[model samples]
Target: MADALTYGLGPDWEPGEDGLPFRRAARVVVLDDDDRLLLVRGHDAGEVTRSWWFTVGGGLDAGEDVRDGATREVFEETGLVVRPADLVGPVLTRSAVFDFARVTCRQDEEFFLARVPSGHDFSHDGWTDLERDVLDEMRWWDVDELAAAVAEGTVVYPETLPELVRALLDGWDGTTPHLDESSVLGPST
Candidate 1:
């Protein structure tokens, strides 16, 4: 419990016997005009030596609209102002059970698509202390690069991100794909 609070999980944070936490997050699959995707790199606070790459987003505020939450996450995490109306689709959804900051979180996440100009500099704004402690870097990724990273034993959440990004190369086809069944994310995942 002290570990959770120390990592800024909040005083209200408490997991059940199975370490089941309550979370609903939003993610933006940010694609630049050059076909590169934006992602962030981080690790569970207790496992700082091992890191994973994931899209830029976070949990929604209570009662927030989905797209609005998605866009808010984008701006807060990346300093990229994405209008809610400009986001493409809630193109994907997934259930993720993962460990971060020594807490096991079960997050139901929605993925939105945002298009940015090429080489929009990374100027993250308003990251909480937890993010500063766990998040390491933010970068633009090409699809093949992501695939290669995964192949080389790097953990990337939504393990199929490369494939999904490839499918969106021409634009989302008006269908939202569920990325996975409820699954734990890790190296073997």
Candidate 2:
């Protein structure tokens, strides 16, 4: 059999077992008019202490387009409705293999950007039971706060997120760039 892929941090991180499936997922980087980015804090399924902050998103259901999946994910996780055309990316595409809820899978992800009015209400009425169990909190963070969190050992997915947000804040054109692996976090292979 081929070598399994590995992800996450530290010595405890391990490779996936044989025959794990691959999943295609979409993520949204929701920003408010104030330039603060929205994030959700959650633990990996079946684990409590290993929480991390990630953008709003999840695996696409069968037959769903990437943009459609992203829009649906954002609404489900944040209760904010947005048009698929309003989302501004596939800003970054990445692949990683990791375990969530003790199930190992390789995930291909596309990240998109969107904006909403400041102080939009975050409602959990749409969250799945699984999401409710794993998700701990949601917050809007400035770049400085995100940098501080990284410095303080908080794990944030797409590791280059803060820099990306800063670029957007610094007048990035709406074009989406395919992020290099070196620019984000993912399996070495």
Candidate 3:
């Protein structure tokens, strides 16, 4: 069997007192005018067949607010520009614990919704070294494609992402809810 893919801190990284490093992150659920979602493919170092797809996001810098962080992450990961006020969340907060690259962490993430024009450029020019190391490709996926990928055992973060996207496209109520660990998919064990 192939080794499972992992995403988190690397071997040389360390956590705080709890043995799990805590991170505050902001993620953008980017949709095009056609309602297709944009997702990125990633692979752990040296792992080819075990790639996974995830939204555009990352840890918030100290003193940065969530909306600002979301905007920054989107631009950094995809080269798309968006105003903080245009983002439509703290739609969901996801708490997860996992081990990746031999390091374990507890990540608290906030998800925001952003809409962009179709065919917008998703360039890698803005990525940090760590992001460039793990990220492989980016694509736009319609709902059916996303659902098919999930059914085929492709790993996607938040586990509930497809449903969430559908909800948003179907007309989100604009309420922010907390997504507990049970609703999230952590690292494969």
lDDT per residue, candidate 2, 6-26, as tens digits?
Answer: 322222123334355455779
Local accuracy of candidate 3 as per-residue lDDT tens digits, 1-189: 111223345332235456555667889899999999998888755344566788888888778898998898898888899999989867788888765555455677889899899978667788877677778889999978999989999888877889899999966697988877732335421
In candidate 3, list every pair of residues with a backbone clash. none
Order of the predicted models by lDDT, top scorer first: 1, 3, 2
Which is better, 1 or 2, measured by lDDT? 1
lDDT of 1: 0.77
Estimate candidate 3's alpha-carbon lDDT, on a 0 to 1 scale.
0.76
Top model number, TM-score: 1
True lDDT of residue 159, candidate 1? 82
Q: TM-scores, in order shown?
A: 0.88, 0.82, 0.86
Q: What is the lDDT of residue 182 in candidate 3?
A: 33
Residue-wise C-alpha lDDT for candidate 1, range 1-189, written one tens digit per residue: 333355566533445445565567788899999899888888766666878888988877778888998888788888888999998888999877766656566677888888889867766667877777778898888889889988999778788889999999998999987765456545211
Off by over 4 Å in 3: 1-14, 46-49, 182-189
The 10 consecutive residues of candidate 3 with the worst lDDT sum are 1-10
